[model samples]
Target: MFSNLSMGALGLTADLPTAIDLAAKHGFGGVDPDLGYLSGLGGTSAVSEFASSVSEKGLRWGMAGLPINVTAPGTEFAQQLAELPAKLEVLNAAGVTAVGTWVRPMHDELPYRRNWALHASRLSLIAELLADSGIRLGLEYIGPKTFWSTERFPFIHSLGEALELIVEVGAPNIGLILDSYHWYTAGESADDLEGLSDADIVSADINDARDDRERDEQQDLDRRLPGATGVIDLDGFMSALRAAGYDGPVKVEPFMKSLAEQPVDDVLADVSARLAKAIG
Candidate 1:
């Protein structure tokens, strides 16, 4: 596992050039690709030029957020799906091989079975689209009970459930975006991750839960930087990744309120140090 700089996840703001500079300066091995920044450059040629610059700095590309929103209405989803090919072209030119999107753990109207099929169908289409560009798609499972409780029906909120959906999608490129926050909240152990190989995971996020709350009581956004207070079992998490031979980027996704209030440079330096400590 290698440390990755995910600017938005850390609540830091910078242009692509500046983000790359910060990533290199902070000792990150990878930086999450800013899809908006790449798209703004207008074409594959411009994106390739920018990608070369990042490559020269010795930073590998971390997973990019999937541009299509799976939870959107059917028409909107179709439109986004239609536009996916062009967006993927830019990512391919930039050498980004992985992208991810989260699944809402509940739905207002759809029951569990219906919701599962809906997600499987949508994600299958996306996985196929990504595979055409030689990219892998990571599907994130939202594990906090607080999130799923808000709706009428609970969907996939655990690693096993997410794997089931991935199988339903039935595409080779479909995989997991294994997150420590979710892994902890879902009552999973390091043993639960032992079954997965490197190919089973496309990317990962490392964060800590607040000590004040029990596992199920945790909220998705109420997280600390990795190693903060040692509230979460990060060592076991990293050990499992190693056991699985996972060589992908591991980015911090701490949605701490205090972290969001700090200066970008301070947040970057602090997050970088925290990640190094946690992973080591």
Candidate 2:
């Protein structure tokens, strides 16, 4: 497995070029570039230029934002689907292997089963679109119980449930973008990871949580850097991924506001050291 850094997680508002440069300088082997930034650049030439810059810094491109929205219905959704081919072409040229999006309960007004079916149908279509490009779609399960309570339809919040949804989608390119924070909140054990095949996972995020809060009580913004706290068993998490044959990038996605307030270099160095120790 390799270490990757996400600019959003770091709370660094740097543009793509600066983010890539920081990622390489701070010991990250890969980076999850901002999709918004990439979109703003526009066209295949811009993507190629970004790819060249990443290569020049010796950094690999990890996952990027999803190129299309699969769940939205109607003309807006149709437009997103229509634009997918060109967007994917740019990503393919840039050597991006996967793209990811979060799956949460957005339609609380609908019954859970109905909403799930709708999401499944849409995702299957997306998976089909991405499969032709040899790109995988990574779906992140939102695990917090509070997140579910606020949703119109309580969505799948567990890794097991997410896997079930992926199976129902029945696409070869669809997989989980496993996050340690969600794993902990969902009450999943290391054994859960061991039960999965490498193909079931497209990528992963590594971060710890505050020990002061209860598991279900932990908020998204309450994250700590990996190894900064003992609320999550990160070493065992990595071991389980290895056991399951996952050799992909594991990104540090600590959402701590405090870390974001610190110097970028200091935060990056600290994160690198912590990740190395945990991965070791």
- Which residue runs of candidate 1 sit more than 4 Å off their true CA positions? none
State the lDDT of candidate 1 residue by residue for 1-280, as single tens digits.
Answer: 7889988887766787888999999899899998889989978899999999998888999999999999899999999999999999989989999998898899889999998888888888888889999999998998899998899999899999999888878999989999999999898999899889999999989999888988778889889878876878899999999889999998899886677677777888888887787667
Alpha carbon lDDT of residue 45, candidate 1?
A: 92
Q: For residue 153, what is the lDDT in candidate 1?
A: 91
Query: Residue 212 lDDT in model 2?
Result: 91
lDDT of 2 by residue, 1-280 (tens): 7788787876767777888888888888888866666667777788788788888888888888886665676688878987888878877778888999988644657787887888888888788889999999999987777677776667788888888999899998999999999999999889888778888888899888988989989887678888777889888888898888887778888777777678989988887787677666
What are the runs in model 2 whose C-alpha is more than 4 Å off?
A: 39-42
For candidate 1, report its TM-score: 0.97
Local error of candidate 1 at 275, Å?
Answer: 1.8
- Candidate 2, residue 27: the lDDT equals 87
Candidate 2 has which clashing residue pairs, if any? 108-152, 108-153
All candidates: TM-score: 0.97, 0.94
